[model samples]
Target: MKKKGIFVISLDLELIWGVFDKVDYKEKSSYFKNTREVIPEILDLFSEYNIECTWATVGMLFNSTWEEWKSNFPENFPEYQNEGLSAYAYGESIMSPETEFYCFAKEIIEKINATPSQEIGTHTYSHYYCLEPGQDLQSFEVDLKKSIEMARAMNIELKSLVFPRNQFNSEYLKVCKKLGIENVRSNPTDWFWQDTQKDSLKDKIFRTGDAYLGPINKSYSISSLKAEKDKPLAQKASRLLRPYSNNKILNKLKIDRIKSEMTYAARNEEIYHLWWHPHNFGSNPQENLKDLQVLLEHYKRCHKEFGFQSLNMDGVNKQFQNILRN
Candidate 1:
């Protein structure tokens, strides 16, 4: 039973907290509103397919109002060398009724909590950047503690974490383990996926091309994870489910590449983990949902033919633990 193929899906639910450093709120306000509107629909699709997903939400998003958000800030804030990278600084003048949809999402979090087989994981208290400069282990721990505290306030115990921006730092796993995180979404082993914070134009080009051309075998055998004794198992990501594209031919190729990879994992009895941000669907929710439905349908076929199973990060971690115990 353990040899069967495993399928894992994770979502980084950051609202604007994830992109505040990069995008302007006023210009992308409608985009954020669309994202809030589409989350329920996405959850409904997951239910229809009996899919289990891990939503690694930013802790700041749990607040219903601006005042609540301000009160929940960590005692010790991360002091990044570049001040623009600080969410706390950005939040100073950003909260209002106009930006309410982008800043707070407590109601959306409740909807996800109500969904069956869905795991609510933390994306850190402030979407903290682990690999960024001027941030230390002590500060990271403070952020994680704040995240756990906020989730607990909502009756949620976060067992899984997905670092913001795929900044996969092995050093931080110890902090996560100490704070009760069972697993974390690590970056893929391929060179193109490594050191994402310092990503180069060449690497970016290759990553995008790999999505359509199949430059590498993204899936891996579960036995590999068994070899590691790390407490917070590093559940490596296989691919990012790139958002809807207007170019029809390119979109088809991207979908084909994903199908081919899933087929490989299913046939070889390996693990295939796919992830993306919920806001990636904001611009074109219908098209994104259509593509997602196609992928889920492929997953059903793979499950029927090869015993492929859909599990969240928590489920995958539990399965790995069982193997170790046996």
Candidate 2:
């Protein structure tokens, strides 16, 4: 009998400007640009494993940056016009267009499109915060529609989505379905600010918490200044202890989490959705990648023992839909 396992790797592809609007891009472009090198390495690794992964890219990244690269640097950066740039430059206002930033992002988007065996998904038009209660549903819908349209403009077909900030609004699911999206990567109950409806059996859910599987603990908080100050000690300890914390630990803990939520999936199995920004790997990417590699290897081992198989978000949702039909 084959062991049951599911592996879902979701990427939130956005520029540092989109994430950190406060930073001065003109002076700090290199700092923001440095973080992006890890992305190609990640793509390479996924390619090596023949991994079918989901890239929840910000549509503006493609339209703005990629388009610019094509028009501005056609000869030297032919790939940039279609592929996507490593970084982008944007202003303070969220909705405002920053042409320079778009130029960079467009190249990056094109590059991602060129990669084979990868699925491009939606992250939202401007990386909106859906969790903010004041954000009206209409506005959310409009932005969601815009994101889908932007992808269409790029001639890219979007099949999956991962909410920005893990802010899964139930209403957004309807928007996704209407847009022909087949699946979404959502947070599990154990993560912070999870939705009450997420516990229901009807929705397709994925568990996500970086610390839970890696050197850190899910419960650890970094919000407080005090916590940040004290984290170095814990970080050092985690580095020393990580080698000993093997697949056995991951299997035991992750399986228990899945079993607890098995009923929510109606025993059909829920996607163990693991996701994070590619930039997150930048701080100590090699170490982070090593940890991820260990987890992936463990997932492969588990696939042989359990019945679960690794899937991109679309593949997982298709399987779930098939199960529902029966």
lDDT of the structure predicted as candidate 2: 0.53
Task: Please give the CA lDDT of all the candidate structures.
Answer: 0.90, 0.53
Q: Which stretches of candidate 1 lie over 4 Å from their true place?
A: 226-230
Worst 10 residues of 2 by lDDT: 232-241
**Model 1 lDDT tens row, 213-325:** 85547898777884344458889999999999999999999998899899999999889999999999999889999999999999999999999999999999888778878
Candidate 2 ranges beyond 4 A from true positions:
1-3, 21-31, 65-103, 195-270
lDDT of 2 at 281: 63
TM-score of 1: 0.97
Q: Provide the global lDDT of candidate 1 against the true structure.
A: 0.90
In terms of lDDT, the poorest run of 10 residues in model 1 is: 222-231
- What TM-score does model 2 achieve against the real structure? 0.64
Q: How many pairs in model 2 have backbone atoms within 3 A of each other, for residues 3 or more apart or on separate chains, i.e. clashes?
A: 28
Q: Which pairs of residues have clashing backbones in candidate 1?
A: none
